[model samples]
Target: MNALILVADDEADMEPLFRQQFRRDIKAGRFDLVFTTSARQALRIIGDAGQHDILLLLSDINMPEMSGLDLLARAKAARPNLPIIMVTAYGDADTRRRALAGGADGLLPKPIDFPALRVEINRCLAQWGAGP
Candidate 1:
């Protein structure tokens, strides 16, 4: 099945970068990525899209409106089973601890290593007994 990953960040450049990085997987129908620039938008999408289709959620800890940590709380409240990973450039022990406490499935620091992201995605899918 195709995994639909929703990534919420304020970075406008991320879409093209992610597309380029995951082109092979996207073409193979192994994964599909949806991007939202704000946590609020992401939350709305998550509410509307349902957790079954959205295999994973990747969100930046910093954003204009709602923070990723807040999104984590909202998403987890809506769907506790959903896996949501928090990403940020300001990743530190305190931030990591807060994210974990807020129910984030994983915490990834930026500049995101695409290869590591791939591994983490696969591991997350395996954990949920899904694929790609």
Candidate 2:
């Protein structure tokens, strides 16, 4: 089965960028990416059992209503084993520390380095004994 990645970001353009970047993997049935504009929606998806076979979560820190850090904490609480990576343009030292403290698996700054992200994704998936 394909490994699913749930992404929470307010930026509408991110959807296309992710889909384009992972087109090859998507076509190969290795990975699937799902995008949501808010933490609420992401939390809903996470809370709903068997809604999606999510292997990882990629979230933007500076989202509306709730921050990614908040989501990371809640998501971790809900699914302690799920890997979460925080993606933000404001990746300050404090933010990194807090993310790690809150149980985030990784963090990426914008504009994201897709190559590095791919490496991290593979590492996370391998650690979880899931997809490539």
Q: State the displacement of the C-alpha of residue 107, model 1, in Å, after optimal TM-score superposition.
A: 1.0
- What's the TM-score of every candidate structure? 0.91, 0.94
Local lDDT at 131 for model 1: 65
32-58: candidate 1 lDDT, tens digit per residue: 899999999998888985443787899
Tell me the deviation in Å of residue 125 in model 2.
Answer: 3.0
| Clash count (model 1, backbone only) | 0
Output the lDDT of residue 40, model 1: 93
> What are the Cα lDDT values of the candidates?
0.88, 0.90
RMSD of each: 1.8, 1.3
Compare the candidates by TM-score and give the number of the best one: 2
